[model samples]
Target: MWTNIQAKRPVWLAGAAIALAALAAYHNSFGGPFLFDDEQSILHNPSIRSFSTALTPPGGFGFTVSGRPLLNLSLALNYAVSGTEVWSYHALNLLIHVLAGLTLFGLVRRTLALPVLAGRFAGQELPAAFVIALLWTLHPLQTESVTYLIQRAESLMGLFYLLTLYGFVRAATAASARGWQVATVAACALGMACKEVMVTAPVVAVLYDRTFLAGSFRAAWERRRGLHAGLFATWLPLAWLVATAGGDRGGTFVLTPEAFAGYWLTQFEAVARYLQLALWPSPLVFEYGVTPVTAWTQVLPYAVPVVAAAGATLWALRFRPVAGFLGAAFFLILAPTSLLPGITQTIVEHRMYLPLAAVIALVAGAVMAALGRRVWPVLLVLALVAGGLTARRNADYQDEFRLWQDTVTKRPTSAKAQNNLGRVHFLRGELPEARQRYELAVSLDPGSAQTRYNLGLVLDATGQPEAAIAQYAEAVRILPYFAQARLRTASALLRLGRPAEAVAPAVEATRLLVEPAEAYFTLGQAQAMLGRPAEAAESYRAAVKHDPAQAEARLNLGIMLAQAGELAGAREQLGEAARLRPQLPEAHANLGIVLAESGRLPEAVASFQRALELRPDYAAAHYNLGNTLLRLGRVEEARGHFTAAVKAAPDFEAAREMLERLR
Candidate 1:
């Protein structure tokens, strides 16, 4: 018993070390702000803002499919605990990554300790597995998936993916494997909910059984036919998810021959690039610019090396089945994204979150096999270097400015990166820098409607309305469905006093489902400018109805209603606006005017006084208060207010007339 306890010490110590190292490497990333997709998928995604909504299928929160319900649910859980604080989300992502790493350690150790590989691994299984897990955990290539908040979709799925495999391995070797088998199936199902990549988990499980447990596919199938069936059946949910989800699958089976060849060639290059990054792990970028191969000549250079690598992997399957398993698992996990035709992105580093496990495992196995029992020091050095690189990479994600700057530096032609970096500068009010980045982005990707729209925004802000209108029109021409661009175009046209021209785009803007409130508000502005009061009033009403928290919309709607002689409706809206934004003197003054119109003298006086208190120099509030007081028969008070109004606004003709009438 004493010897057995002593023998287990190194494993426990190594496990603890891996956890600590992972934490230390990612410590700077705990406060990193959300970047890129995080805005749409986590922050602005209302479905994940509440537990009930998150658990239910996304109704209209812009999440087209409820397929990633589990990922959404985890984000909701994080929100509940942190309420939009960046720290908690990053903490959860790190925790998931650590757990996945620990699971990888267990799975590798168990696989190497099996009877078939046991003699070969001898006493090195524990340390070998520890090194693989530690190195993989600290690998800089993993920072994108782990430190980037939205990519929890990848890391969380990876955790469950590894858990399913680890549980299956334990079950295959355990005295009673039934419970473990059930847990494995459950884990696979959970992984499916996290991401579609998990569809490969069952197939990998089958391969693992063949390589380590049963020694042959036929014997494994015979022994665990029911288990195999159950594992395969887990794909049913994933299939249903893909079928029901709104995803970009257009490039799959329908790609034209030219397009297919182009995409296929691009994928080979992408895979080669991924492997290079995995080995070196320097200058990891958030986005890469991939140009499709339009001609055979464009693909030939990449094709030879890619084919040779694939051939080597296949040869390993015939001669060295274990290495073959790792190679096959790597390809299988990547096949969905790489071989699949429709994905817009040619390569994404986070896609390697699971595939990297196989790479690290194979490398560690090779090192251990060559060095025998003397690989510890070399492994330690690799871990320290990887950990240092990971920590530095994590530092890049500490802020959007750093992250996007790094992306632009690494992939200068990535138009999206340039556009996003421009947005960061725009948010910080660095207009010239923002303009420079936006211009660069547009030049790099002339057809990108988003970059055009962003450029239009900066141009409009700098008072170049004509130039801004031109950019906006180009954006609308490039993507007719871009409702925001249409609205911006209308706004710029209105600024240029072209209300009639603005009307068409403003009306078109109202047809979109996204940000209907803003669309309606823009439509109302255009209609009002066209001197169509009734239509303007209706559009303003629609704007307020869609987004009641829109104080400006409510104020505008109330004023329009008052002009349309709907004084009672105007008072209600104006009062709500005042309540929503008490700091706005305009809200209080407008509410007062509506109250006085409806014959509520006391409420009108109080509203005007509140407006004046917020802004003592408010000439309109003072003039309105005087009229309300005179109507209430408070002659002395009315006279005093009228005099003050006239004094405050010496050029106020309306106040002068009211004061003379009072005297």
Candidate 2:
């Protein structure tokens, strides 16, 4: 029994068993409408919001850091069908994490060349791999990376990272056995399609060859030179070098030589930061911001030698200790994100997600190798302690408010954290608090479009439409294709009774395919107010076609259809809209209009009652109900609704018209 339990497979199985246990401890993101980029990432994201849109070339879904069109296409598929259901998104994230966990295990097991067989009968082989992957899957530090729906880029990107590494392992094995290179090439190509971040895979492969493939350095380098060159040649992922992108294009700082120097200096600080977090992670945050580092003078270049020498020393000193290779692997994988110029922050905990496995593998392997006969007692205690810490850490990610609030508390200087905290206040309708937070955010980051846009929203809520308009306008001026900014501006114009002035920009917004349904819906409302019923009807029809599930859009479409004398078509649209959103007062009210217009007075009265049930003070629903009742000679019922309508909106023209007739 002791002999069977002492093997590599047993350890892996034990780790997997622990991970599976962790999954059941709490539901993944059990409640969330959406958060952060989920708006564009899941629901309004054009890639996912539209069908028949190409994902490649001049005009495509290019809202990515890695220029990965296929990943965007898949996410678009997620949005189109699932439509922001938290469970669906959570489930998908969970599934990807699971696959990644399994893949990590596979990669580690294969990389170690552990002697194991595949079967319940055969049992676990690579115990260290099992420990590594297990630690990876259930580590609390990784909860945000795996659970945040919008951070699909992190998890999915890491997946390709693993694939690229795993492919290198497979290629090395095949080469050793004197097999074909096709599998290796195919895997690398697939990794690129998944994420351009895997561009470092070739360099990693070369190092991996030197570290693990051969017992000696010179032989391994010789074996992998051709493969490394081939991989490097094919690794042209980031073809463009645009400095600023996304909404408001507050964009990244310019990459000047001085900036480059600061960027390089940041790597040492980041290296220290990551190492610190790896040992004792605390005060985890979603946003490290555009300024996570300070400018570095030439005097601050001390980190270059420290990190490099430390890594070099570890490599040079690892005669028989696998710890050297493990440490080296962690540094190699993490170097790109850490050493790069473009990443917003100088340090992030999630950046360690891909590399943590190396630490786990090394530590677990040491434990196994050192105290081979008496390892069980030590391993058990370590698992419990690690698992406890992980569980405690994950509790923070239960919701955005808690997470962001904690972030600000922990890292008060984090402007991004402040902005996110303010967003939480705004989303929750704490307007005064929201305004205060937004003001703080803007003060901290004057150039941030996000903060400025948010400030505009708060201003609009306080009835400062002109100021709000200016902010939104500024946002658009900075970020020419910001859909939310465009929509906000157009909606503000409509509210300000300048609906005609709202049309062209709204149309342009739709033309840019930035939330086309929202732009069209808002444009339809503007055109309707401008007395262009025909044009309004066309816009509303497009809105419904773009998002059939939008009850409000369908309600507007039905009203327009009825006005255009298409009663049957109008009724069908409104009825479906009402059925889709039984709680929506407008859909029921619109259904009543189409029903009454088609001379179905009794049915129209019922629809109006449903509308009033949802929104008792809805003047249009009350007015329409009154009209229907009056038509049916029910003076008493008609009088009640007419009175109700007049109270709901005293100055409402339609309500006034109905009440006067009823009196």
Candidate 3:
């Protein structure tokens, strides 16, 4: 019993060390704000804001087909618990990552202890597994997947992938391991709900069985046909998800020889880059610029190492099957992204999250085999260096400004990074700085409609309406189907008093499916400017219908209904607008006007008071309140309100005339 306890202590201590190291490395990341896709996937995504919507098929704003239901559900739970505080989400991401690292430790240890590899790794399994897991968890390249809130999809999927493999290994080792086999299949299904990358789990598991447990593919299949069949059948959910859910509009499955060749060549360079980063792991970037290989000459430089790797993998399969298994796992995990065309991004670090496990395992095993007992001190030094680097990387994600600044610094040619940096400036109200960044982004990627639109937004904010309109026009020209750009053009035209010009783009915008509410609202503004109240009212109603929480739309619709003598409808719309946005004085003031018109004197007085309480300098609210008070024969109060309105707005002739009359 004493010997058995002594043998178990090292494993427990190792697990504890991994957990503590992960927490320490990610301590700063817990406060990191949402960056990039996190805004669309979590922050502004209404679908994950509620439990019911999160559990159901995704709908509402920001629902991308890449919407992983299980990942979304986790985010929803975080929202429910902490309500967008950022800390809870980061904590959960770190927890998932730690669990994945633990699972990796278990899987690798079990694999090393198997009959096939046990002889070669005897008495060194624990240390080798611990080193691999430690290196992987602390590696700087993993910060994007672990610290960036939105990339939780990658880490979460990786966790399930590891769990599935670990369960399979456990089942293969045990005499009656039906429960472990069932757990493995369940884990595969769960992984499918997390991300599409889980599609490779079943294949990797079968390969693991063939290489380590059953000695060959045929033997593994022959022994566990039913179990293998169950594993393959789990792909049904994944297939259904891919078919039904809207995939990223960027990637395509269609393969042309030319396109395939270019993508394949680009991936070779990417693989070389990944290997470099895996070894050095410095100056990690958030985004990488895509550079496709258009010619064979461009591919020649990268082809050598890729070819060497392929030959080594083939050679290992015949002589050293374990190495082949590791090699196969690395390529199989990377195959989806590498071979796929239209991936938008050619190289991304987070894509290496799963593949790194195999490389780390092989490296750690080689180191242990060579150094024997002396490997622990070397691993300790490496882990400390890697953990320190990881912590520093997490600090870069402390906020969007720091994150994008670092991204642009590292990847200066990345238009996305420049544009996002511009967004940070724009959000801070530094219009000139924002414009400069936007200009840089536009110059870098002249064909990107988004960068052009971003430039237009800064131009409009800086009072250059014509220049803004030109940028918007360029954006629309570049991407003719861009509804938001058309809407922006219409808005800029309206700002420049060209209501007639605004009408065309505004109408065109309403025809597009994207942001129809915003388009309809812009159309209503243009129509109202052109003296078409009836059409404007219809457009406003459509805007409100599409987004019920659109307080500005509801307020405009109410004002239009009031002008059309539909007082009851006006009252309802204004009341809803006020309820939706309690802080908007305009909503309360408009509600007051409709109430006054409908002869609800007491409610009108209360609404006007509420509006004034929200905005003490609101001249219109004061004026409307004065008129209501004068009608109710509150002579002194009416005079005071009229005076206040005239004081708030010196150009208010109506308030001046009303004050004189009241006196």
Candidate 4:
């Protein structure tokens, strides 16, 4: 609708309006919880808990291969203030999104100064800039970048990306004694730290020099020599940092130069896909997986739009946009992600967070220019309507459950969607329904580890421990260091009374990841079973150290201490276990046994009484209480408990004999 507002005052007002609209649209994100990979990337991570780990290359977020230190540093800063509050994490993401919007507005405004795109605005720089910024800020597709807290790396990186573009464009047009050169390069480096996407930024800088600074090929090359020397000089250190940080090479998928070229060509189709979505954003999904670039139907068919754009670029060699920044900036910033050899799959909504800004700006400015003097009202309507839609979409990200539920509802055949939705159901105790969804997902695609792991969890819950073990075994085999599968395998083993056999897998898990409290607890139980009481105690201690809520570990540790004759330590550990799990009938019953043996008869009787209070029909507690009373010389009381125990367990020889002795 934007084809009018070609004036400075109107543009300034539109910029302010976009700022307020974006802020209002996403304010609810302050309550969004950690979702999806946030668990592995942030919550369960040990390194992020401490400041020292924040600075290292493989730092601040545990020792995983994901060494985005700048991202870790931002998370570390978030942790320093509030560890896991949903509001704090969401607030940080919102701040980054809003700030990136502001930077995008600034970049657009600065681009208007260049001769190429400025003429399209018919001499009005401000109007074209406002329309671009307004649309970009309120686009519904960007909700993923803002609402998914962990993906703030994209939004935050975009801020620096736009800053680098603005400074470089201004430098090329103004040339100002090269003073801005250092700032431009520094911004580029920071952008790279924020995300590896900045690799495409240098290309954008050259395009700005070509289109705005000097358009002819020879002049652009001549102008680029000194800037290239200065720029690449700094990029050498950035390259080193990137190497130290490391990235997923798609495991042999990224090793080929031809594959890189194929990837770039495929992104041509991807760009067309993005354009299609911009026009009609239906059936959107947060995940598209590593979508294959050149499907048989898509290879020939998708080339139509890409070919058109390419031909347009060739023909438009004589006539360029006034800002001159849109084509090169869009192409430049987008190239690393869209053209990279191997990284993510071919399509993801989050990838659009930065590039869409350029595309939207180009479209909005061009639309306003074409309408000639009536675009202001239309721009306002577009911002308001888009902002409303974006706000509506963000409501889906309120929780993982809601997000995936929406996904499955929108894309019923999407196996990933079904699997994630099943995970939400499983987390909330709808086991039967979760199993139903997981089975559907498996039927759709058996290759996904996430689906298999989820199905394993359901099987384990339904008492099919052996089947669950098999599922987890397969998952771990596929992804050897996958912490979830390894932990589940150990848990199933423990449940099947094969805890001793679980030691190997649990050890493997710890060697790979210093997390999984359940694994450590299960390992301790297995060690204790193998006659390694001392080692078991240390394992239990580590388990409780990582997760203070491990009451079972504490009680087990206490029992081992009692058996080892460490009476004081046994009582201390058991007492803590009791305090932690008041309803644990075994904890109270065991406490009574330890106390009676320690010569605390009155305390022993009371502990037994409490165990009875919690679980009145507990046969073991009745049997143990009967024995404790017998030791205390309460013959009558002992007989009563013995009678109850025998009634509770009809095959109880111990209760029958104990009652006979009392008589």
TM-score of each: 0.91, 0.78, 0.90, 0.87
Say which candidate scores most in lDDT. 3
Off by over 4 Å in 4: 1-15, 55-65, 80-82, 115-123, 169-182, 214-242, 249-269, 293-295, 314-325, 341-344, 399-402, 600-602, 620-639, 650-658
Worst 10 residues of 3 by lDDT: 56-65
Q: Write the per-residue lDDT of candidate 1 for residues 26-70, one digit (tens) a residue.
A: 988988888876876776666777788885434222242246778
lDDT for each residue of candidate 3 in 561-599, tens digit (9 for 90 to 100): 999999999998999999999999999998999999899
The local distance difference test score of each candidate is 0.84, 0.69, 0.85, 0.74
Q: 663, model 3: CA deviation in Å?
A: 8.7
How much lDDT does candidate 3 score? 0.85
lDDT digits (tens) for residues 548-597 of candidate 4? 87889989988989999988888888888899999998888888888988
Residue 630, candidate 3: C-alpha displacement in angstroms? 3.2
Q: Give the TM-score of candidate 2.
A: 0.78
Per-residue lDDT for 205 in model 2? 68
Once fitted onto the true fold, the runs of candidate 2 whose alpha carbons sit more than 4 angstroms away are 1-34, 46-66, 69-138, 174-182, 214-259, 292-328, 359-380, 561-663
Better of 2 and 4 by lDDT: 4
Estimate, for each residue in 1-663, the C-alpha lDDT of model 2 and write its tens digit. Answer: 866766555655654675574565325454544666565545555555555652541222324422555556667566676766676666767667766777788887776563222231122336656666766776666766666666666677677667666767777766363242455555565566554456666766666666666655678667666666656665654333111122211333344677676676666766666666655666566666655345455325556655674666475546643566666667777766655575346666667777777766766765665565366556656655666666665566667888888888877777778888888888889988988887888777776667778889989998999999898887777667666777889999998999988987798878877458888999999999999988988898898888888878888878878877888888888898889899988888888888887889989989999988888899878888888888899989888888888898888877677666656
RMSD each, Å: 3.2, 6.0, 3.3, 4.7
Off by over 4 Å in 1: 1-12, 55-66, 249-256, 294-302, 342-344, 494-511, 527-546, 560-569, 598-600, 613-617, 632-653
* Greater-TM-score candidate between 2 and 3: 3
